[model samples]
Target: MSSPEHKQLIWNLIKDIKVGMLVTKELNDEDGLRARPMSLVQDAYDGTLYFFTSKTDAKAFEIAQDKDVCLTFSNPKDNVYVSLTGKAKLSEKRDLIDQYWNKWVAAWFKNGKDDPDVAILEVKISKGEHWDSTNNKLVQLFEVTKSNIFESSTPNLGESKKFGTE
Candidate 1:
């Protein structure tokens, strides 16, 4: 698929998945990485993603120290998984913060959209990889079984593609 088409496919795969794992590298800890569950802002994906976060949150601090980050989304029932790498930064842009605000996000802040702690974590996605299994359970199981018995080949699960920045 074309780049635009691939991006749309990714959006379709993840649009319903409300939560994704946000992975960040801890400051001064080269070998340590932290991952936390975060909800997408659900506006639109135009090579970027947004999440609501507290400016004082550890993630915000980590992003300030190192912009590189990874995000992961999955749906076991559908057998779809995505991993995205990007650069992230914190923002207090009220207009943007208000645009993506909803009751669920507001619950995290005591003063609604006016809270000082409310911040927007913007991730400029550079590239991503995804695995999508399109076969039915029976077919998938058959493939797995066949592969196991054959002992030399792997199962033909589904489409696996890499998208974004070459």
Candidate 2:
């Protein structure tokens, strides 16, 4: 599929997931990588993902030193998973923050939109890959049994695709 089409498909699959695991490089730590759950700022995906974060948070500091980041979205019941690689930067754009703000966000920024600590993290995606599978229990059981009994062929586990430009 075309790049635009693939991006649209990815957006469709992940927009509803609402939350993703944001991975960033660890600073001065042996852990190497640190991942934390972040809520999506908007439902419409356009190769850029946004999240609200504290300006003083470790993630914000980490991204400042190394802009490269990864976001992973998954829905076990639907058997959909997506991993996106991107570059991120912190923004204190109040207008952008206001546009994405909702009641759920207010809980974190008790002082409302003017909260000094509130910041927006924008991730410009460079590439992504996704996995989708038919995870019905019956289908899986049959496939597993068939694969074991037949021993000549493997079951159709799922579809995986890589999309986006470098």
Candidate 1: residue 124 lDDT (0-100): 86
Q: Write the per-residue lDDT of candidate 2 for residues 1-166, one digit (tens) a residue.
A: 2366777888888989989999999989856999999999887777788999999899999999999999999998888999999999999987889899999889999999899999999999998889998768678778889999999978876899887676
Per-candidate TM vs. native?
A: 0.94, 0.91
Q: Candidate 1 on 7-109: residue-level lDDT in tens?
A: 7787898989979999999977988999999999865677788899999889998999899999999999999999999999998998898799999998899
**Cα error, candidate 2, residue 84 (Å):** 0.7
TM-score of 2: 0.91
Q: In model 2, how large is the Cα lDDT of residue 161?
A: 88
Q: Worst ten-residue run, lDDT, model 2? A: 1-10
Q: Candidate 1: TM-score?
A: 0.94
Clashing pairs in 1: none
